[model samples]
Target chain A: MQPSSQMLKGILEGAILQIIQQGDIYGYALHEKLAALGFGDIPEGTIYPLLLKLQRNKLIIGVRRPTGNGPDRKYYHLTDEGEKTLTIFQQQWHQLVQAMTNLNQGDESS
Target chain B: MQPSSQMLKGILEGAILQIIQQGDIYGYALHEKLAALGFGDIPEGTIYPLLLKLQRNKLIIGVRRPTGNGPDRKYYHLTDEGEKTLTIFQQQWHQLVQAMTNLNQGDESS
Candidate 1:
């Protein structure tokens, strides 16, 4: 199951950064790859805007690649900043998980 | 280390709800518990506003209880809707973790 919009709100950017970090990918193609990886149905509206925002923030950069059949595709690639962000995201995520584990286990005793 | 504000924005509400669900707690006490649980240094300004918003949304309700030594403590509890939200949050969280795991693993193979 996919997350609620609210849940996805904070997480999607990091996920997208991670995806782009793996390799450069275009906007539409990202959805397919995200779905294949089990993120479920992500809307183009959400993806494009976040991509623009990431570029504005210097976390990612888009390179226009020519396609014979269509307009040039803006393929996104992660910047070093984005890689650092992903590392922080991973650490924070695991910390939250561990803390939650402690909290849940503490339920029995407290 | 704590998550970035952007990362925590969507998650704090559900975490607060889960905390309240586990036990009736006041705003200040919630922080101590949250920090203890390793959510890191969450500020009072953030918690109070969220508590008010949750109450406004009817997900949580606060009851003022008398404390002999101090002002009344408004303790929070979850509504039926809040419980359902918590369940969904748990499922969504697990789904996200699993999906992220898949995405990362795919990197090695693809």
Candidate 2:
């Protein structure tokens, strides 16, 4: 079955929090990572707006960094608040996966 | 390790696309679903802007429906382009999980 957009939002939010917890990163680099991870067709438009939202929520802060080549890039770093949020998101994500796993297991049992 | 914000953006984008692929839904309902799924701390501000972006990209279209008791709410439905994107995303997400899983397995082996 196809996952609903609502379900996708939760998953995405969790994933986003998890990514930010790793290190400071810029938009293009992030997109490249996603593409490298096999999301080659993922739209280039989605990331910036989401980044802005994440920043607005105080979960992340942005800094301008000079690139070796071309223009300065905006890189995002996780704040303390962002770290706390990631912890919560991680716990929730594990619970969700466990619940889904159990449900799938039950389906197999029946 | 904590995920960087850029990484989070990709995960979230894929997740959001997946959710819309499942069914028609609105911002509040999507947020509620996220909360139910364990993202209780997820800010209410991020979703609408993302939704608008998705809509603007033509991946989703909105319809306003009256609630049984209050005001009408805007619901988003995935377009054909959205479904195609989801297929690509799912393929990519599976690849990501497989790669990560393999890496984890390698770590355990070592």
lDDT of 2 by residue, B11-99 (tens): 55555665555567788877765554443334567788878888898888999999899988998888889888666665555554443
Clashing pairs in 1: none
Model 1: per-residue lDDT, tens digit, B1-110? 11223333457677788889888999989978877777776779878998999999899999999999888899999999899877777666566666777777764222
Model 2 agreement with the true structure over A1-110: per-residue lDDT tens digits: 12333333454554555555566778777776554444333455777887888899998999998878999999888888989877776555455444333332332121
- Ten residues in sequence with the least summed lDDT for candidate 1 chain A: A1-10
lDDT of 1: 0.75
DockQ of 2: 0.09
RMSD of model 2 against the true structure: 9.8
Q: Taking the true A–B contacts (Cα pairs closer than 8 Å), what share appears in each candidate?
A: 0.32, 0.08
